[model samples]
Target: MSKKLTIGLFGYGVVGTGLYDVLHKSKTVDATIKKIVVKNKDKKRNISPEHFHYDKNEILNDDEINVVVELIDDADAAYEIVTTALKKGKAVVSANKKLIAEHFEELYELQKKYNVPFLYEAAVCGSIPIIRNLEEYYNNDFLQSIQGIVNGSTNYILTKTFQDNLSFDEALKEAQEKGYAESNPILDTGGFDARSKLQILLAHSFGIKTVPEDVFNVGIQNLGDLEIKYAKEKNLQIKLLAYAQKRNEEEVAALVIPKFVKSTDTFSTVNDVFNGVKVQTAFADKQFFYGRGAGSLPTASAVLSDISALAYDYKYEYKKIENSENLKLTEDFNLKVLFRHPSKDADKFQPYFENIEEYYGNKEQGYFVGDISFKNLKEIFSQNSEEVSFVLIEVLH
Candidate 1:
């Protein structure tokens, strides 16, 4: 906090440019971008050519730059940049969820070893300030569960499908056209994006470390008119949800999957590109966080918050990392699910269910409401040859 805060920025993408604009416009933060490293120097941009640097070393080697902001898309490259900056004893802020989730332990160790701040508030629900809230406000509270619609692309698509009565493909196309989805949106639609965000939250909320592969994740790619109709008939709304719940003092359950949300529930009302997180704690019954989950400005605002905090020498203690030893992740909890498949495939799933509440079938498709353990349901889906679709039934506490 002696000299003016100098920034070493990586990536000149949407969020990166937005951050630059915000920083330049702000009168509070005494920060200036020393250098910006981008992949392509030939790409036309509004920024001056003198401001861009093709070599990352230009930023990494500069002693004046005490803070590095990484807004890159590639997780691998982002990892390299962030690790390098942290090792160099510079404060780092990133929006890369995949990189952070995959290397949480390594990054925490780097923070301890180098004694520098590594903050990533824009990684989870964009502009929601969930991470900071979990790190500060809920630090003393015993959190029982964290559940939400974390991805905006899938949420927009689902909203379109439900309200506009559009098909899955049509909804996806609309999301793409509106810039809510990527050209190749597999990561977003397949639930991997939300899974990564959930993993990051698990560390802060429940003091647990987990990977996307360990979580039971299912995408919305298989949802069709039939499933949408079913949800409407049952007076429900379908949403892609990510959850982390404490099963016991020592055990926690986590997953990212589509669920049938009750029409009356708050989550059901969360539509379009809006995101909602419901945190259940021991003292506080339930608290909800809502915001625009994605977009350049909204996401950039979160990243800027971390940057501003860094200007004040703020760094996360990662208290959860110290208390995570006894927290074990499991998928053994029993849940009520509605499974849909071809009529001929009904018998294959029936044996896995502990109890069946209702069985309905037709020539084209069949579905059943039943109770099944998460482990068994995941196993059944994994072992099956054909694609299987299932949605978690909303349970009111």
Candidate 2:
């Protein structure tokens, strides 16, 4: 682990290019790039052609390459590359959240079996070092809850929609144009991306391993004028929040949904492409972590930090996971929610949610504020997804 790192980098996309630039400019890390794997050899890149390779074996088979950095977009392909790299006894670094989150257990097993370091600090919150803090800093503390706006693209879109007076579509278009969002932005807007990240965090934050599907998630895609108007009237802002809290002594509840945040709340000030994480612990109280959540350089910086840590023989020990024999992931909790829809569909929902706390509307449109169990929330969302806008009402004690 002390020898100079010979890196085999995969995918010369945005993050890849940024990593190359940062590595070359960095004088502290004693690492050199041996080869970079790209899908299309025909695509013109600024780097020398000799550094790029289309075949994965060229790096996988190279005994000189000691580190493998995987930054690809495809989860399947990234999985193949990472497994091959780890099996070859090479330390691995990756920033693919979807790949890492979906295959976390398998990858953890691989790292243990092969006895190699596999670090992915950029997978969760871009430049924020929440993963490292969760592993090293909060190792002994009891966590009560972890919540924040983990998705930057949605935050940017929401900021524009609220502050800039732009529609959701317009804000999304701007984000895509600025490289803040993907070409197919469903993963970001649909809450799937945040859910994947939350899946990874739950393991570190609460020692709970759960699939992304198991976590109840509702995105900002269904957001419209009705929800925005209501929030403005209430002097609140809407943020797509990822939440994981201790429901009791043994179970932890997790969800990714839009929540109504008051202007005085700390999360309300976390806008645009910046990411914010609020961790509530037993002894430390509340701690805040904030940084750029998107863009090439910010993410690449995190990747670089992991690469640097490799020089010191640093790898996540996953202390919380080893001690989590009784902890479990659960959804047995009630959430205060605001449901807005057209007046015509009122009956479609009222029969389901009998415990309505408040109701207001006319012939054209209407809404209700009440509490719903996680089970019923999922059922209602599945049936009336297009007709309703559901938002979590953040009630302070």
Candidate 3:
């Protein structure tokens, strides 16, 4: 029989409290929270104050606590807590995608060195369990591509904008008010959040390790009524999609960008705070995993699943990553795109595209449908022209 887990939980925010409630209510889970570390002292909490501590050593030095659950938002601080836990030979579970994506190589080495299980099912897609599925179920499958709506905050904002006729700003404000987005929502709106998750998935799906800066990602921050109206005219909905596809045997292409999904498509129907991941493999063909991508309870459920797995001595094998195949992540592919900008500045943007397939211009604004290399897309997108926007016409892998 597996040993009962004594958990030292860090961060008492949304998901933290949800985990506490769920762990207690779960009759099957053989884990108990021995200590919870939080920053604030006076903040009202759902649990008793006796269970909370302000110091990291309280949990890190506690030999009885064999599992460390890091749910903090600050990546730097999260790194410290996670590393300390691992060095102390404690199994670790975390939901911080940024920390995992940024220091994946180091964390992987740490787990191997300490010979401890480090599982993070919550970091990728709230309750979807994509990480575990990729690690175990899809270990032997020859994966062709992995793509979907990985971020829920932006999805919520986009859903409200198109479905409820709310403006982008209004929808974003509503998401923040409802706790779907953070107070400073740039991580979600700017596509950084999804990019982090994609980086983590690349290792599991294709055994490719890459940085967030190398991956070109443009989010819904520039989206407005113009794009929504354009989508409606074309019988489509705009979704922020993070995708990775095997271009050939040795090379794989990955990117996160806004795209037009046809009304008949699966992602078009995956609206609100829900996330859908479509994995294409040689054997299974295509399968879609859908669930709540963000929320206190939903995210906590994923975290709790990891805690349960730790009891049974389960950890990610990273089969694809450890395999002999030398897979490389590349951005050399060509993409069909729709670039919308002020008509007056149209000529300035003409040189960026390889060739314009179609063009429409008026006195106010215009759009260009053309093909552009992923490398050039990064160069132009860096200009950060507020008057301009870019969307994938279709994903060509």
Best by lDDT: 3
- Per-residue lDDT of 119-199 in model 1, one digit per residue for the tens? 999999889999999999999898999999999999999999989999999999999999999999989998999999999
Q: For residues 1-397, could you state the per-residue lDDT of candidate 3 as single tens digits?
A: 6779999999999999899989989988899999999999999998789999999999999999999999998999999999989989999999999999899989988999999999999998899999999988898888999998999999999889889989999999999999889888999998999999999999999988777776778888878666678788888888899999999899999988888899899998899999999999999999999999988899999999999998899988877878836899777799888888888988888898998988988788788888988877777767755656655556563
Per-prediction TM-score to the true structure, in the order listed:
0.97, 0.96, 0.97
Off by over 4 Å in 2: none
Identify the runs in model 1 with alpha carbons over 4 angstroms from their true place: 1-3
Per-residue lDDT of model 2, residues 1-397, tens digit only = 4558889999998899999899989999989988898999789898778888899999899999999999998999999999999999999999988998888889988989999999999998899999999999998888899997889999999999999989899999999999888889999999999999999899888887766667878888878787788888999999999988887889888889889988988999999999999999998899999999977889999999999999888898887888886999776777777888788888888876647888878777888888777777778878877776655555411
* Cα lDDT for residue 133, candidate 1: 95
Pairs that collide in candidate 2 are none
Model 2: lDDT of residue 52? 85
Residue 327, model 2, lDDT: 91
List the global CA lDDT of all models.
0.87, 0.87, 0.89
TM accuracy, model 1: 0.97
- Lowest lDDT 10-mer window, candidate 2? 388-397
